[model samples]
Target: MRWAPRGCGGTRPSPEHVKRNGWHDQNILVVSPDDQRLTWPERELVRQLGEKLYGTRNISEDRNG
Candidate 1:
């Protein structure tokens, strides 16, 4: 699926608003039916977005290596 802003030619999901507030439920990456994994880069991206969405920011990183 493609996620581009209305007038941005359906580019990748890299909107300032999205980058700052993280991706919407529809945009969050899904690893499995029950597990969700966000990379370090993605984590930071979403953290900023969550802050804007909820007015506060809180993210718990689950490292598995």
Candidate 2:
């Protein structure tokens, strides 16, 4: 499956936002993984992607690492 923002003409995800937020921004398409508009699977995918990209860092881990 392929994903792209409307009118993006095949644009890619925003790396800056992803790095800054410690989460994948999906090219600014996904405002949040918890967005109710997204299907459960989509939300789950976003969460997993975020974890994979940023690592599953907890509050303590963030503070220390």
Global lDDT of each candidate: 0.52, 0.67
Which 10-residue window in model 2 sums to the lowest lDDT?
22-31
Candidate 1, 1-65: lDDT as tens digits:
46766787844655545644545645653221122465666666666666666666333566453
Maximum-lDDT candidate:
2
The residue pairs in collision within model 1 are 20-48, 20-49, 21-49, 22-49
User: What is the C-alpha lDDT profile of model 2 across 1-65, one tens digit per residue?
Assistant: 48666786764668645555554443344346767978999988988898988887463555444
Q: Give the backbone clash total of model 2.
A: 0
True lDDT of residue 55, candidate 1: 65
List ranges where model 2 is wrong by over 4 Å: 1-30, 57-65
Could you tell me the C-alpha RMSD of candidate 2 in Å?
Answer: 13.4
